[model samples]
Target: MTIESVLSNNRIIAATQLKDIKRADESQCCAMILMNGKLSELMHMPMVHKPLFIHMDLLKGLKNDKEGIAFLKEFINPTGIVTTKGNLIEAAKKEGLLTIQRIFLIDTNSLKTAIQNIKDYRPDAIEVMPGIAPKIVKALKQELDIPIILAGLITTKEDVLHAFEAGAEAVSLSNQLLWNGTTEAITTK
Candidate 1:
């Protein structure tokens, strides 16, 4: 299924920055971005009903190559994956997993590079860093066909609303309160 279909109702995805299993379990978000969890920890953690998108960078014991992708698919069995690497995104797609390519928009050059990469890799969706850049989000939304997930530095209801207004399909934030506090606003959108 499409990322948009999965995230259509849930606008705030829990971004688990640390290995806080308790916090993740307590979160109201229906989707999660596992930013910092070891392979063992992830494997052992109790599964929640929502979709889990593992961050390849923070996850240990995997090579981020074809073999690692295989391991993730066979063993970890995540609903999807998040990575900045185009190759990994391609590999994950081959393995029948949804992919979210994380792009850090530091400047114009980076944005250009990310756009080119998107054309090449064709991930199911993309997560843009520093979600405050409404202009950049609007630009990317205008250019890209896939859904955009605005992430990072999003701690308030206004930030969430602004991202949605700028054309982000959803927003990922580490703050749990925002997940609860912003649901009404997102649902009404």
Candidate 2:
């Protein structure tokens, strides 16, 4: 399914730790980004009902190559992946996994470079970090047509609301409390 469809109604995506998979699976979050774990941990990961996206960069012992992408598809069978590396995004796409390129808004030059890289790699979606930055989110939404997911340092209901107001399709957070609709902010149409 498309990331946009996966994030449609309740736009919160649980950015989960391996240990909290059960909670995320049961939460109101429309989907999940599995942000951390060992390669061995994933081998034994339980099957969950929701759409799952693994963060390739943080997966220890995974080579971050085409081979690694193949293994993930065969084993965990994730719906997609989140990564900062353009090559991994490409690799994941080649392996038929939906891709989300994580971009850090460090500065103007970095943002320019990231936009170019995003054009080149062409991931299914893009996740902008430091979700609190409304202006930056607004700017990026103006520039790109792909779905935008805001992540990192988004601590409260207000932050989630601001991100949506700035045009984020969804917000990914590790906060379990927020995963169950505590934020209660609907995306503005």
The model with the greatest TM-score is 2
TM-score for each of the candidates = 0.92, 0.94
lDDT of each: 0.83, 0.87
lDDT of 2: 0.87
Error of 1 at 120 (Å): 0.3
With candidate 1 superimposed using the best TM-score fit, by how many Å does residue 26's alpha carbon deviate from the native? Answer: 4.8
Q: What does candidate 2's lDDT look like per residue over 30-75, in tens digits? A: 9999988998888888889999999999999889899989999988
Task: State residue 91's C-alpha deviation in candidate 1, in Å.
Answer: 0.7
lDDT of 2 at 22: 91
Instruction: Single out the weakest 10-residue window by summed lDDT for candidate 2.
Output: 180-189
Deviation in Å, model 2, residue 60 alpha carbon:
0.8
Give me the displacement of residue 24 in model 2, in angstroms.
0.6
Error of 2 at 181 (Å): 1.4
Tell me how candidate 1 scores on lDDT.
Answer: 0.83
Where does candidate 2 stray beyond 4 Å? 182-189
